[model samples]
Target chain A: MKTLLDLLMLSCKKASELIDKQLLLNLSLKERLMLKIHTRLCEACFEYEKQSKLLDKLLLKHISTSEESQIPIQINIELKQKIIHNINPKK
Target chain B: MLNEMDTNNPATTITSWVKLYSDNLFSWALHKTSDREIAEDLVQDTFLVAVNSFDKFEGKSNPKSWLFAILNNKINDHYRSNFRHQTTNNTISLDEYFDANEHWRPEETPQPWLVESSHILDNPEFTKQFEECMQRLPQHWFSAIHLKYIEERKGVAICQEIGITPTNFWQILHRAKLQLRKCLETHWFKI
Candidate 1:
């Protein structure tokens, strides 16, 4: 017989892993149902789900704009010539 | 200025590739490697390889992807070589997160984070902390996550580019996300 915790609990680690994995691929129906059940009963898992969703959103925005926040490193003419030279020593 | 015909002319366009593609490539390389010199070298090497292999030019894909493919190879080779030197701490024992019977530990339990954490991206301090946390990750793990979340590459493509199987990719991503969440909690969220 399955214990109460087995039916009710989603370990924090497994919940977090499933959260990250969903970003890469879809979770199975059983996995999704288990997560839904666990999050309803487990406050911690619920919070983790919220935070991870927010994290994915923030990460997407941060990465897209990260370059804009800084002055980009310039490749000067000298370096251009040096690169060309390295690529074509004959020239 | 680059017509389809001109792109095929290695003599004319290849040298000028530096002017056209170097800055963008350099920025991408810098973002991936996080070291200026290595980034610069990778960009140079990419162009060098392109020039040397100009005979085999097949312009089926756009120039950007072709160049990025070369740069990705350079990045892959780099982290693989560095892999042997660095001792990566990827062995995150699940025992710490759960009890023997697999319940969350009392002290280690997750708490409700702010609902408006998406707004945290607006805070410069939090962004700095996020970047610092990212830097602390193992190189391969960082590269994989960066490609997934930042570059927005698909999972299969990222796995192929990074030379890992899909299973390994997921495992790396799991450990990386776990560490990242912990880092953010301490530095930004502060439960």
Candidate 2:
């Protein structure tokens, strides 16, 4: 018979796992049952799990949409020239 | 991730490698320090370090990883150099907050502050407040929180990168969270 405090800690740990959706999806039946029980009794853990899920979604969205521009042609040429000059000073 | 093309020409090989890795190295340093100018300097320093040690690279790993390994060392060196000059708050013991025996026990199950995604992005005030709260944190706690939450690095990776044991990593993370929670509740939470 786990105390409410013990149950709460377990729920907190599971809430953190919500950040990784793959882990969330892979939760064992027993773990799912435990989460269900904990969320029903613990509003804080429930809210934490929800917020963690939202945060993960937002972060992934930000990362995926970010574009990396290619280096400018002039800058690349200059860099190449500089390297060539360094390697062969007489040129 | 290596851009190794015809290493027979040392000059061309070095130039290609620098061009290929410059963005990645800068990004890595920027993430670590959250400063663009500092990141650029660090990346430049990394290239110099890499050139001097090119003979030691031995093709054991991808060039990107190798560059990153050097960049990480550079970042650590920067931290070490500035650590002596930095002031840290000594009022509270972050260690006590993370004791496994006294784990996080929020007074009441905190209700999630319901803010839509668009609202979060649009509200400059919210962002400012959050940044302020983050600035108040101790350096180690701030680094741990940023690495864990913002960068989304794993505990094991953080442990390896920071050269701390897993237990210490957890403790640091726990302390950071506890401090952040407290800060948000006290300053940012209007309701």
- The model with the greatest lDDT is 1
Tell me model 1's lDDT, rounded to 2 decimals.
Answer: 0.70
Q: Worst ten-residue run, lDDT, model 1 chain B?
A: B83-92
- The 10-residue segment of model 2 chain A with minimum total lDDT is A65-74
Q: Write the per-residue lDDT of candidate 1 for residues B108-191, one digit (tens) a residue.
A: 666666546456766767777877888887776776665666556678776676556666667777777667777888776674
Clashing pairs in 2: A44-B109
> Candidate 2, chain A: TM-score?
0.52
Per-model DockQ = 0.44, 0.14
Candidate 1: Cα lDDT at A48: 73
TM-score of each: 0.68, 0.47
- Candidate 1: where are CA atoms >4 Å away? A1-8, A61-71, A74-85, A88-91, B1-24, B53-92, B99-108, B115-119, B122-124, B150-165
Give the per-residue lDDT digits (tens) of candidate 2, residues B20-89: 7666666556645655666767777776676667777766677777887788778766654443334243
Model 2 per-residue lDDT tens digits across residues A11-74: 3544433323232135566666666676676676676566545544443333222222321112
Off-target runs (Cα >4 Å) in candidate 2 are A1-32, A54-91, B1-109, B149-154, B161-168, B189-191
Deviation (Å) of A64 in candidate 2:
9.8
